[model samples]
Structures are given as structure tokens and as C-alpha cells.
Target: MTPFQTLTGTAAPLLEKGKLMSNVDTDMIIPKQFLKTTTRTGLSKGLFHELKTRADGSENPDFVLNKPAYAKAGILIAGENFGCGSSREHAPWALLDQGITCVIAPSFADIFHNNCYKNGILPVRLPMDVCEQLAALAGGANHVFTVDLATQTLTTPDGVTHAFDVDPGRKSNLMAGLDEIGASLKVAGEISEFEHKRRLMTPWLEPAI
Candidate 1:
């Protein structure tokens, strides 16, 4: 996973009436038509493509992401069950490709949340009221927000702050830029020691080189 330090950028509101519509699934995030490629490149264009386009293929100017103020948004504040569809790593990849570094939501699907962490996207689970408040703040003109992973705090442009929680192991992995394999490699010395002991204890099972 790419290391995440602090992310400071404009945040967009993916909510309605101070709340986000629930069950914003992975299919809705990238849609089935855009899932052809395994590569992460060019996935940004597929992000919210269906929602941002009409049947006639014209842009939907009313879409939050299509709005001028949110075009370059890096943080997305949403509601419950933010990612509640198929278990696909591509979902987070698409969001990252669009420059969305963090997502603040009331809740998220288990698989989706794990995928987000693996892909270097911070998936914050705040209370519903807190998410609503953050969403409202995100609506301000060009409002900027900072997510400090080290401190586990989110600071808004108007000086308001919110504290959040992240699993210590996950936090460490993100901070150290280590994926699962990379994290395991951090204990390579211990692994070698274990192997040596195993070889000595079970010499009859050893294979000839």
C-alpha cells in the first residue's frame, strides 16, 4: 500500500439533505461497463460515470462530482454503508485514481473497507451525526480539510476538529507504506530464525537442493 501521511485537500459532500444515501455500492462507484481493465490507469474516468452521464451520453451538471467546486475534490464525506456491493479492489482503485485520498462515512462494508486500506485510501467511520456535520462543512466554497493519520484527527477549514479511530496495525502499515507482504517482510529476520529452528528440529523432512 502507498504510505499515507497527512492528506490536505478539498472535500466534497456525497450526501443529500445533510445525509448521504446509504448503500453506495461498488457497482455504482465504477459500474460494470468500466470493469474491463485490470490495470489501475484510466479508472478515474469511470468513477461515477453512470451517475455523471445521461442516457444520451451528456454530462449531468447537477452531479456533486461534476459541480465545478468539487471537480478536484480529494476527500469524500458520505453516509452509511458507503461501499456495500461486490468485493472488488477496483472500487478503491477507481476512487484513488480520481484523486480521492480519503472517505469519511458512517459505516462501510467489511471487504470494501479492507480494500480501501490496502490501496492507501483512508476510510473513516464517524458517527452519523458527525458525518452529517462534516458533509455540511464540505459544502462550503472550496473548503479544505486535513486528515492527519498520525494524530487520527480531521480538521476542517473553519477550525473545527474531529477525532477518529484506526486499527493500530492498519495505521502502522499505511504509515510505513507496507502492504500485507511488505508487512511480513518487516519480520524477515524472525522468519529466518524460525526456519532455521524448523530445519534443525525436522531434518528428515528437509529437501535436497
Candidate 2:
């Protein structure tokens, strides 16, 4: 996972009929069909698969992400309860693959929120009104937004800054680009030393083979 310090780029607003859409579940982000692969790469093609695809399997140009200006959007301004439903890690994988490094919403599913941090995606929770403000800004011509994890602030395109709270441990891990496995490896030396002492104290426990 890439270390998340600061990200400044266009923010795509996931809206419906000009209003922010709520309850965006994991299946909507990346359908079950795309969950077959354990690898993270190549899932971008399946990102928002249903919403971005027409009945005839053609591209839905109307989709927020399919639009020309938002095609490479690195930030997403969404509604409440984003990333709801199943606890698939592939949801974040697909988002990351699609170049979305930050997701701003009023709230998020607990499991999905944790997965975002683990996968280098910053999931920002703000008041619904605040999120709506950001979403409105994102829909305009100047839709760029900046998310600084170090500062724990999100700056809108018009220079308004909003603060957010994150767990210190999660913040630290993100800044260091340390996932669960990477964080465990950071204590490898201590683990090895403990194992050596344990074996010295109980030689009989060693395998005969």
C-alpha cells in the first residue's frame, strides 16, 4: 500500500439525479463477479461495473466516473453510509485501482471503513451537510479537492478546509504505508529473539525430524 500523506486532484461526485446517492454498498462499487481474483490489479475494469455498464454491455457515459473530466478522479465525494453491505476487501482494491485515493462521505460501513485505511484509501466522515457541500463543489467545473492525512483536513476547491478525526494508530499506519502484515514485520526482530529463547528453554519441544 502506498503511504497516504496528501492527495490533490479532481473529486468525482457519485450522485443520482443531481443529488448525492446514499447507501452505496460494496457490490455497487465492485460486483460479485469481479471478486473471483485475489490479486488487486485489473479490478479497475470492474469498478462500478453495474453502474458504468449499459444493458447491452456498452459504456454508460452518464456515470460519474465514466465522464471525461472525472475519468481519473483521485477523490470521491459521496453520500452517507457509503461502502455498506458485504465485507469484501476487493471494494477498496477496485477503488484504488480506479485511482480513488480518498473517499469523503457522511458515514461508512465499519468494515469497509477499516478496509479503506488498510488499503491506503482515506475514508473521511463529515456531517451530511458538509458532505453535501463537498459534493456540490465536486460537481462544478473546478472539482478538485485536497485531502491531507497528516493534517487530518480536507480542503475544498474553493479553499475551505474541514477537519476530521481518525484513530491515531490507523493514521500512523497509513503515514508509514504499513498494512497489518507490514506492521507485524516491523517487530520481526523481537519475535525472532523471543522464539530463540523459547526453544533454548525447551529443547524437548523440537521436532525429531
Candidate 3:
């Protein structure tokens, strides 16, 4: 799998931000069965369709994505505020389970956004209008995109590019596959140093049994 170190898809594909998120609900991103995976991926088979009622293989006309503007959405151009719900890391997992490597919305719930990063999904924020245009594009049969994390870029299949913002530390964690605890352990020395100093300031500072 190509780790999207950098590239953009859909809207600015190169720089998608403040995406208007015209459609697509969080429930459609991942279904219940996928909640079982400890690792990401392999959730693709159950994605979208998990929530889509097909009593048979027939599409659920009432689904958000069934609407022309959101069909074939590879980059998930979504609503003003997205990823809102109980903190289910599985939500992002489900998004990753599908082929969606990146998501662009106006804003993301804190825990949900962090979960996306942990699972190798790059959740982006874009201005609302940008997302609207992309949703419009999804109306066509060939709606798709590419997100490149390395260069912090978003590129459309047509080759347009856009720049995005990310915390350097967080970006490094994603590039290096360091989870929060993993990254903190790499700085054990610094933590140790601080503890030593605190001990000096108060000899009895250590916690009692």
C-alpha cells in the first residue's frame, strides 16, 4: 500500500482544507462488524455496504452516498463538523478499512481525528466551498483523488496540487508509525531527567506506597 506521505485528492487534492462536507454520514463510513479488527485494513469488504441496506445487492436509494454528488467518493468530502460521536477509534478504522486513506471536512471531533492519525488515515480540514465543488465532481462516474502525506500535499487525478498544515511532531509520528505511547517512550531520557530534578527540589517528593 502506498503510504500517503503527501498528495491531495478531490477538492484541492493537493491542499484540501475547510471542506464543505455536503454529504456522507459517519455511520456509512464503517459498519459494526469491522469494530472487531485490532489492525487496520481488511475492513474494505464491509465498508459502505455495511450500513447500506441491500436486502439484496440492490443499492439503498435513501443512503447519502446514493445521491449523485457523493457517489464514487474516494476522498470523502464531508459536512461542516464531522466525525462526531462516542470516541470509537473503530470509526476511523472503518474509514481506513475502506480504500479511503484521507478525509476532508470543515472540522473533526478531537478523539475521532486522533484515531484517524493512529490508523494511518489523514483527516484534513478545508474551506466549505472547496468541498462542495468536489462533491459536485463525485456526481460524475469517475470521482476519485490522491493524498500524499510526505510532502503535505493533495493532488487531483488531473494533477492539480494543494498544500496543507500538520504539526511537525504529529507528522513525524505518522511517517515513522509511532503511536502516542510509542513516541513518548522514545523520550524516556527527558522524563527521567525531569524526575531527577524534582527529587533534588524536594527530597521526599517520591510517592509513598
TM-score of 2: 0.92
* lDDT of each residue in 142-174, candidate 3, tens digit only: 555667677777665455666678878778887
- Model 2 residue runs over 4 Å out of place are 197-209
Better of 1 and 3 by lDDT: 1
Model 1 residue 165 CA deviation (Å) reads 0.6
lDDT of 2 by residue, 82-200 (tens): 99999999999999999999999999999999999889999999999998888888888899888999999999989999999999999999999999899989999999999999899
TM per candidate comes to: 0.94, 0.92, 0.69
Worst 10 residues of 2 by lDDT: 132-141
Please write out the lDDT profile of model 1 over residues 8-80, one tens digit for every residue.
9989888655457688999989988888999997998888887788999999887789988888899998889
Misplaced by over 4 Å in model 1 are: 16-18, 204-209
Clashes of 2: 0
Taking all chains together, the TM-score of candidate 1 against the true structure is 0.94
True lDDT of residue 81, candidate 1: 93
Clash count per candidate: 0, 0, 31
